[model samples]
Target: MRADAVSRAVLEQLRELHCLEPEQTVCCALSGGADSVCLLRCLLELRPVLGITITAVHVNHHLRGAESERDRTFCQQLCAGLGVRLAVYDVNPAARAAQEHCSEELAARECRYAAFAQVQADWIATAHTASDNLETAVHRLVRGASLHGLTAIPPKNGRFLRPLLRVTRRQVEQYLESLGQTYVTDSTNLTDAYTRNRIRHQVIPALEQLNPSVERTVSYTLRSLRREDDFLHQQAQAAYAKCHTGKNTLSGLETLHEALQFRCIAMLLEEAGISCEAPLLERLAALARQGGRWNLSGAVYAVGKSGTLTIETVQLPEPLPEAIPLQMGENRLFSGFVLHARLETVSPAENVANIHKKFANACLDYDKIKGEIFLRPRQSGDRMQLSGRGFTSALKKLIQANLPPERRRTAHVLADADGVIFAEGVGCAARVCPDGETRRLLVLEILGKC
Candidate 1:
């Protein structure tokens, strides 16, 4: 390719990044290294044609001591010479690592991205080349990565864009040479101490010997995997919608294909902001296939029973201490639920079975109530008459028979001086239930519990 063609190849990759709006400023993450220097130069050249403004930001991670400071100084000089505005952040990665309880590399990456986030730009550009992506894929694969990890670095991740993702490191060096530009090299990259460095120096070269164009081959494979991953992701989304029983719970996951089943569980975990590896996901699938429970990280637990999986946070709700007065046609808010009561004329089409079938809503015979109704947590000695029993049953017995133990404790009930008029998640008291001769009804609705 020609010199301009080489630069344009990188620029084309940048344009391919998602969410690249026109006429927005591009913040270049310049590290004074070959890949980043080439990225900054290409973005600067393309700025006028693409109708975008350019600014460069550099972070001094303070891990290499004076060498890191030298890199920062070089970035400042380069930006000044090119007339591009620059922002420099001085951060101590060791101190950050100590505070965050993470490795130095992770702390450095976090600090660098934090510095990028501080810049006011529409898109933050990074210099991750195809070579870096190949190395990352190989390293992650060795460490037991899934299909998503095999796809490697994304072109656009949130506000950060890897414009040189399709460009090789050799192309970056060639582009810089054509522009008569020089870049500082990080000595740490030459060391084999880090896994990524080991992969770049040892693993990738060994694979390249098997196939001379290994990087290109990996890049092509990654693109294909990305497309396939996207299709599977969409299928998983559709399957998840079907499996959804409620928030934090899914059903019929066991019936789904293993591919969709794993993705569905992963989606749920991600939605909860919880992290789980392939092993945990596989265990969860097994739980769905059979029946079991697991306590997961982030104070969450998963229970699989009867082909249904429910993931719940560890924080249980605290029931209200006192009874709440319920006024007709008014909404009452309790600790765990909201109650709304309104009087309605019983329609001829509405029957006892229909009213009792709606869990959140219940139609009670209005005339049978002798006092004001109150919404309260189930108290000991509470009793409710089953619709056909002709006698009141202990509320605890009713709840235990119908609801799980956890739900039974937190469940609320509607009551008056007469007795317990209705039990939550159970059914309305038999005495207060609407019958064929009932003219008026108290439509009570209890919502938003567990």
Candidate 2:
């Protein structure tokens, strides 16, 4: 294909991928390199036809001495020549690297994205080409990466868009040459010191010599892998929904294939906002296959017993506090308290059931009691009369029958002017049932710790 045709094809692909609208503002990340320069020039050329406004963002990593400054100046001049606005940010790459405890490349990337996010553009466009994706895939595969890493860089990630991923590096240079555009070349790109440069200059070419079209083949393979990866994610989600009990259990996990099992466990951990390392996952898998127990963050554990897997959170050392008084429609926050409350209306029948549960020390009807509901630490004299038993029982006896000894003192009780109406870790008073003519509803949700 001719250079112009290839350039047009790339531009069309970008236009489709970006879904450019005339009114939308696009921020193009420019480094004055051939790839970025070509990207900026192409977008400028298409602006009138696509009815979009273009803005150039140049992030000076301050790594290449005078060359970095020159690139920013060149980008500013280029944007001026094209009648587009330019935004420039100077970042201390070395300082950031030290602070973030990351390599210079990763620090620079983070700084670049942070700058992009600060810019007032609706979308940020980057000039990552197909060659970069191929390089990334090869690099990650060599490092023993997962399927997600093998997929490499996605074309669209959040507010960032890579419009040139379908294009080649040579095609970008050719397009720039056709427009008589000169771009700065970074000396670091030629050095073998960086892993990416070594792959770009040495590894890719050697592979190409064996198969001449390795880049294209790798790109196609990535596309296929991405589709398969998406399908596996859907299947994993469905499997997770079925075998997952309200409480953690590994019983059904053994039935799944090894790959799905790992995926399901990872998803579960992710949903729980728990970090899952590869070693931990392997340990969990080993425990599932054998009779052993492994402990993880937040005192959670996985144990294999009798060909079944069970994941459970360790019981808290301290007992939960009692339920506190909450105003109508108010949300309550209590430390070590399992029950939460909100006000809602209930019919008379529901009120009677609620009162019965309260008398039986089962549920708390917070609205039925008169006076202010206060939460206080358990006192020695606290007592409540059981409805069916017709006998007043000491709080200690009530707690012994229901909870462990460790929870006796830590438990709080809800009280009013009448007396200890509700035991914090237990039930409410039976005498405070709402009358039949009552119209208001109060809703209290009690959540138990896992």
Which candidate comes out best when scored by TM-score? Answer: 1
Residue range with the least summed lDDT across 10 consecutive positions in model 1: 352-361
lDDT (tens digit, per residue) of candidate 2 on 115-160: 8879998788898888898999989988767787799988778878
- How would you encode candidate 1's per-residue C-alpha lDDT over 1-450 as one tens digit per residue? 468865677667766654656789999998999999998999888877788899988988888979988999999999999999998888888999999899999998988777777899888888999999999899888888899899999887888888887788888888888889999999999999899999999998899899988888889899899989989999998999999879988898868999999999998888888897999999998987788878886457898988888887777555456887778764554555666778778678877666556423477888898788887888888877777686777888888898888667667688888878888778778777777777788887766652
User: Could you give the C-alpha RMSD of every candidate to the true structure, in order shown?
Assistant: 14.8, 16.3
Candidate that scores best on lDDT:
1
- At residue 224, what lDDT does model 1 achieve? 94
Q: Which ten residues in a row have the lowest lDDT in candidate 2?
A: 441-450
Clashes of 1: 0
